[model samples]
Target: MKKRFDIYKEHYKALISLGLPIVIGQIGVIVLGFADTLMIGHHSTAELGAASFVNNVFTLAIIFSTGFSYGLTPIVGAMYGTKLYTFAGQALRNSLVANTLVALLLTVCMGILYWNIENLGQPEELLPLIKPYYLVLLASLVFVMLFNGFKQFTDGITDTKTAMWILLNGNVMNIIGNYILIYGKFGFPELGLLGAGISTLFSRVAMVVVFVIIFLRSIRFRRYKVGFFRLGLSRTVFGRLNGLGWPVAFQMGMETASFSLSAIMIGWLGTIALASHQVMLAISQLTFMMYYGMGAAVAVRVSNFSGQHDTLNVRRSAFAGFHLMVALGVVLSSIVFLLRDYLGGWFTESPEVATTVTSLIFPFLVYQFGDGLQIAFANALRGISDVKLMMLIAFIAYFVISLPTGYFCGFIMDWGVQGVWMAFPFGLTSAGLMLFARFNYMTKNR
Candidate 1:
């Protein structure tokens, strides 16, 4: 055990370096969301609640596409590590194609969903605000996909700072946009919730455009520039990417779907429950994104080692990330537990909502470790491009297990919002253990 710990020591530093920037970037995104929720919540609770519902529906599409683009990182990482720069470029092109296809697919689905959201038994008053908001958000999905593809490409090549900067700029833009649009400042139409949606859509579009400009103008990206527009879809490359990408996408999609679908269950509890659910969701994203930051670093390091055919280093990198994440989880959970009382009041003025959010704190803390574990090993699997197995495992853990558990607890067991959250621990722990085992098995075989 001591020797193993020592082996991982060096890798831990690498993971930290890679992860810290991502964590920071993730915080920027959270800040953007916080600004929106805070600014909008103050105007009227109804608009705030409407944003929660519409965003919940959009979460599935956002998470799914993000997962889908995640397929690119490992391939790009391996190719870059092996000094196959052109191949890396080609793989990135393939990723773009795959991401674009998934984006279009999601666009069609969201279009359909926009048409049906009114029938979801939502409060009649909120639907008027939700309808236009959902449409504007739908328009941003393609830009999100485009940004994610660039992000995955850069992350795979161990250049996360670009994404960090891009996200920070976008967050700032989003906040400003929200302030102006939500407030109807500078003679602009006071479109209320619709303005917030428009601002978000604008910011998302800007993020993708900036990424494209940076990739084209940056000297570093120019070195490997395969004619971005000239790269036609290659059947072999697409098949290979899909083989690795789809499973990972589904795995992540299932996990997100669990929480997202639970939002609906919370809706059935009442408006207060749904509102509280949104607050918890926002808080939970902070931890999830932080862990993903570290996990992504682990993925890059693992891919680096894999390119050299060093199984030992690959395993070491994964565990190194896991150890770091455990520490982070402990610290974060402690903070959340301690701040449960004040935390809710800090976000909104409603005592009822605050109290409900406080009730869900323990459940949130319980799953942080499992969340960190799964993210580490799952990214480890991605580093080695052994994603198909992980995807299947995620399906069982996230979909077959987690969602049903939450639904049963929330409805059949009458646990309300609290019951819905308990399912997270069971599903996340199961996923972490299974992915850990799979990572071990793969490296041991190698």
Candidate 2:
């Protein structure tokens, strides 16, 4: 056991170097989300509930789009590993086109959902709050896709710091925007939830614009741009991206759907429950994104190793990543648990919401291990481009298992919001174990 774990020690520094920037960037986004939720919740619980429903709905789209964008990482990582810098650049161009197309498709789908959001059974009073915020967020999808394209491209080449700094700056802009608009400060009309939405939209656009400017002007990216401009788009590259993208999208979409669609269940409970759900969701991002940050590093490193046919180090990289994820999970879960009673009050003034958040913490902490485990191995599979089966596995874990269990617990068992959250551990752990097994089996065969 000691030797088995000892093998992983060699990979920690490399994975941390690659993953830490992503974690820092994700933490910045978390802070932005915290500010948005805090401002909106303090402004009005009604708006908070509306934001919860709308944001969770958008989360499904955002997460799905990000998954599609992830297809670029392995493709670019392989090219980078083999010193094919030009091809890696071409992959970014293709990725941009692919991501934009996905954004458009999602926009249409989200538009349809928007038209029927009232029909989804959320509180009737919050519709006015939900509609405008939803539309503003809908408008940002394209920009988000574009930024993701650039981010994944850079990450594949191991320049994680670029996205890190860009994201931090963008989030700062967002937080500033959120405060001014939400509070009616700085000659702003205090749009509340809509203000938050508009702020997010602009920040997303700025991130994309900044990435483009940097990509075009920076000497560091000159080689990649050579392919970006000269190689043009290729049918094969587009197809390759799609082939890798859709399965990942569905897989990730399913995972997010468990939380997102369940927001509807929480809505059924009442405004307070839904508002609490949103706060919990924001808090969940603290760890989820952090784990994903490490998971992404695993994907990049694993892909780099695979490109060289070094299956051994690929496995080592993945296991090392898992160790890191579990360690992060333990520490974070402990903190959240210790602070559960007071955590919700940090976001909103409502005592009831704070109490509800406290009730949900146990369920939240229970899934951290599974969440981290799944994130690491899922990215490992992504690094190797073994994604199709992952889609199926996610379907089983989230849709077939998690959703039904949530309904049974939340409704059938009359457990309310806490019951809904309890289903997460089962789904995440099952998915994590299966993914870990698959990664091991695939690597051993190699």
Best by TM-score: 2
Q: Which structure among the candidates has the greatest lDDT?
A: 2
Give the per-residue lDDT digits (tens) of candidate 1, residues 270-351. 7778778888888888788889899889988888889889888898888889999999888888888888988767667888
lDDT of 2 by residue, 1-446 (tens): 98876778769999999999999999999999899899999999999999999999999999999999999999999999999999999999999999999999999999999889878888899999999999999999999999999999999999999999999999999999999999999798988999899999999999999999999999999999999999999999999999999999999999999999999999999999999999999999999999989999999999999899999999899989999998998899989988987899999999999999999999898899999989999999999999999998999999988999999999999999999999999999999998989988899967
lDDT of 2: 0.94
Displacement of residue 275 (Cα, Å) in model 2 is 0.4
TM-scores, each model vs. reference: 0.96, 0.99
Against the reference, the lDDT scores of all candidates come to: 0.86, 0.94
User: Deviation in angstroms for 405 in model 1?
Assistant: 2.2
Worst 10 residues of 2 by lDDT: 2-11
Clashing residue pairs for model 2: none
Whole-model alpha-carbon lDDT for candidate 1:
0.86
The 10-residue segment with the lowest total lDDT in model 1: 223-232
